[model samples]
Target: MDCGPGDEGDGSSPVTTPTRTSSTPGRPSPPAEPSTAGRSSAAGRPFIAGQSSTAGRPFTEGQSSTAGRPSAPARLLASPAGVHAHARIAARADPHGRTVLPVLDGEGPLALRRTRATGPAAHVTLVGAMSGPLGGDSLAIDADVGAGARLSVGSAAATIALPGQDGAAARYDVRLTVADGAELRWLPEQLISVRGSALRVTTRADVAEGGRLVLREEQVLGRTGEEPGLLHSRLTVRYAGRTLLDQELTCGPGAPAGWDGPAVLAGHRAVGQLVVVRPEFAYESPESAVLGESAALTPLAGPAALITALAPDALRLRHILDDALSRLM
Candidate 1:
């Protein structure tokens, strides 16, 4: 089924159509007072005032498509035949050191939402209104952290990227720019890759000498009783003009034979990676951070720490990663 997800629109107004069930339900229930719900969080840090946007709505809730949303000057998508969409966000810090989200825009099925601030970090989540990704679908998130600022990014839940009938693959690309003396914690929970789905993720991070990065990526090949899809993920990290980590992993139904080996994922169905760009973060050898015989962590060859592992499911992967992150600076 080639579902184009209708015409794409920038994240400038409210969502009017009903949501499809194929996409995960990531939105919390409507708050009592919608105006003050943007700054709502269930953890440390005083709520610094914000609002939650829906898969169709912009950064403001209860507002019409043209009534009360921030004007996005740059919008794309000039056709209705393709499924490609784009979402861009810019973040900075106030004089008090609190992170602030300035730009959040999306066009197509993919949406961007800014949730509450958690522990001095601005929280943002991506919501897909369609059943999932179709062929040629693209989503990009760009974050610019000012000097001395801190940003934390999280997904409400897992994203399922399903393949379309056009023989084309879906893509999700993220670019992060950490300024001097800044930090960013990207903790995306998981991505469920369905069978026959060709999904590729390119994550590029440019960190300053004094900047810090604690990034994590969790991947599940397929759900219970399902065959694995095709997943090709690449990570490129550079600090002060030097490449710290540049690696790529490809597997699933379309992978070449002899790709299965003990040296690569073994027999695990899920995988996770936790990368710390700065040496200041405390971390032990990947061999020591073990969940069980089903999961193992191995550090990528680099000057900085690039820890990657495989597990049986998302919960176990998260457990191992959470412990690893707790030990970081």
Candidate 2:
């Protein structure tokens, strides 16, 4: 079965969009409201002690800098723009049956580092070099596990998407391949969608016959007490050339009506899913059942199982997913 998801959007061009104030690490602070004591009001009459008539303008034309150099806003405008980056990882088994990482390449904002593994599997962690996946940025990560090898990949922190100068939608793509008899575990941190940002994510995994996979994905709608931006995600998994799962989800503006309604998110701020594929499932399939209030575990048509859950925050979501993973595995 090839159940591909529908297109989300082109996201090829930049369009001006409104952004909100944010204090996320690596995000720039919005320029302060400029003083408008001498400007004319809309009615051609200016009053008020410390207010500006220019409703939305950041600063007036004749405003002079504190020094000979440009103002802070000007300096911010000249800062480096978003980046296009790709990171790659390859794990192979040695003659002694130990997993080894022959390729761990990091680029731009997507820095890949080899970390200490708890078991035979080689571990790799993602480290962000700078703030990104901002609007207009394109990021991708490719990982491959050779036959008979075991590998695990994780991230150091949550990814925060912020609006860029161009206002374009940012994109992050992940591709994974596991050869026969190999195993892979992809456990990344949550992704937080800040207000006024737009992000699109695609994750595709191909597992050969006898290969095993454990993957997790989590999304946080927004920060504490704040409205979310736009977030679209698609997850596709193929086992031995057959599509096991292909799902798409969208939230915030432009999503399907009532996405956050009772039938969907139900006012939840965090959502996540876990997929586990192993050869053992072919003989003894797991039973479908609900795990608590907002989570379910069901066996797929093939030798695989899926666990989906929702929660009010990232902590609760992680706890739910973790509990489900323990039960399933």
Candidate 3:
């Protein structure tokens, strides 16, 4: 909750919390011996990254690629392309059993770090070393879910979009791929579009047959007691070579946003949405359904639903989102 500039809240704990797990190759968990100091224990658990069915037994020390030394934390990067942060996680089926294994875990700014394991799911949180998306800033996340893997992911704090040093617009792009029979739940924190700031979130996901995906997106046009800024968002989802969702929203032209006029936000300060795609999803989404005046649930094509919550302040908006989620959760 106390997310500072360039720093994130402690999401590694609550110890049972949000985000999700990931994987990649590492030194196998070594046998107890003087030669294998600092080796992580594989005897604890084998999570595919998100949440897997109970069919496969968990992986043991004798069957792990990352049982040895742990992966390093993410670093900050800045280049001509812009200040960019990258995190990649890939999961695979363990040859030893029905369990899934993590083969890669990496990140830059808005770094993704895994905490402890819980059941068939791996916990992960995104932490930042500094304030970002200062116009032209790009954050790209790539996740791959093997044929039977599962993963959950979230951010430790809200993304504070600030004006760029050279007045360029900020960008955050996410790319997710869920293979056959895989699952991924991506629920990051709200994004704060501050006054004079320009921010955008471009997300693209590809889900293979029999896969499932749950994703949440929240945005705040302005912090408490401040004017709104500019926000642009895009979402694209496809499965089995069929496009399920393709949409975009733009608020204001540039720096000083037009929150009062005829924008979709309707002078509101906040908005939130959730999307779910499962193998069993067959209901036709309706155009829109109001939720007690605090929110509206829109059924999109396929097995996806979008909830939009609008309020004069952040608190009310969040409460509305929570109420809407409780029904679906």
Candidate 4:
């Protein structure tokens, strides 16, 4: 099977369409309201005065100090084709942060939602979403792609904020399970952590026999005019039970400063990862070389068929994807 752009439904840009399943229930039920007594302020004022109170400590009076913060959770909207796949997408605020409200809506051809703030360290999980950005109040995504499903995930835009100074560092954990003959394509937007911001991201995937998977992750530092920011990134990818890729990049004033060298980033402002895995199909020499040059691609030397690429721009990365898919076709 070609399994490329044209081979799929329409050739227009891909979008995520979420549908509910028993495995992935509807949006979380709204939390119960606090009692009248619990709504009073510490200064003896009524609940109205307590609405904007900041002097109280965290998690006091059955109300969290971090309530009503900004959080962007995952949403799986319906696709244009209306192909019903058993998919699940859910999120839980981290123990340290506040619980956020995850909005769920279907907009034409895409499903959309934002995570209302819980507190700091609130984390959301996507059991399943086709493709789009995952934003928290802190601005990041923690995603998982299950077995036997074709999932192509991405972000709405580039994230430039970080933790502490601006907020907590954005983090993502993507786990993929590709069953026999299943496929997954994850293409999230680039992540740009500002100078004072911090980020920690990781992705892992499990591929069964005859299964296929494709993944892309990009990280950038500094805005067009802002000074270069700090970035701490670690990526790990697993196939079956074996580790296929492990890399760590820490860029900051205090960290080592040799990334400009030829072996490292070579002063490129952006970096990315594109991976494709299949058991039967293989890349030809010409196609392999083209992919290698476009994204500085690399192939895993093992029983599994996996290709990885690192790029400096989204356009180039997309071009590489097109070429790779064309070759596969």
- TM-score of candidate 4 relative to the true fold: 0.53
| Tens digits of per-residue lDDT for model 3, 1-329 | 11211112122211111111122112122122222111112342211222222221111111122234332221221254345555566655454423333533333344444543454554455543234566776777787877876677766557777776566788888888988888888888788888777888899989887888887888778778777568888988888768888878777555245545655666777777777777765654445668887688776667667776778776787788777767665
Please give the ranking of all candidate structures by lDDT, highest first, separated by commas.
Answer: 2, 1, 3, 4
What is the per-residue lDDT of model 4 for residues 1-329, given as tens digits with 9 covering 90 to 100? 11121121112122222232332222221122222222222233111111222221111112122135321122122221112222222222323332222322222112222221132321211211221111222113333333343444443344443333223344444555655545556655566656665555556666666666677666665655454455666666665666767777876544576864677766666666666666644343223344565354456643333344445654565566656655543
TM-score of each: 0.74, 0.76, 0.70, 0.53
Candidate 4 global CA lDDT score: 0.41
Q: How many residue pairs clash in each candidate?
A: 4, 0, 20, 31
Model 3: C-alpha RMSD to truth? 12.6
Q: Worst 10-residue stretch by lDDT in candidate 1?
A: 1-10
lDDT of each: 0.60, 0.72, 0.59, 0.41
**Prediction 3 TM-score vs. true:** 0.70
Per-residue lDDT tens digits for candidate 1, residues 117-185, read 536666665543343554456667777777887777776447676775565788888898898888888
lDDT of 3 at 153: 73
Cα RMSD to the true fold for all candidates: 8.6, 15.4, 12.6, 16.7
Runs in model 2 deviating more than 4 A are 1-81
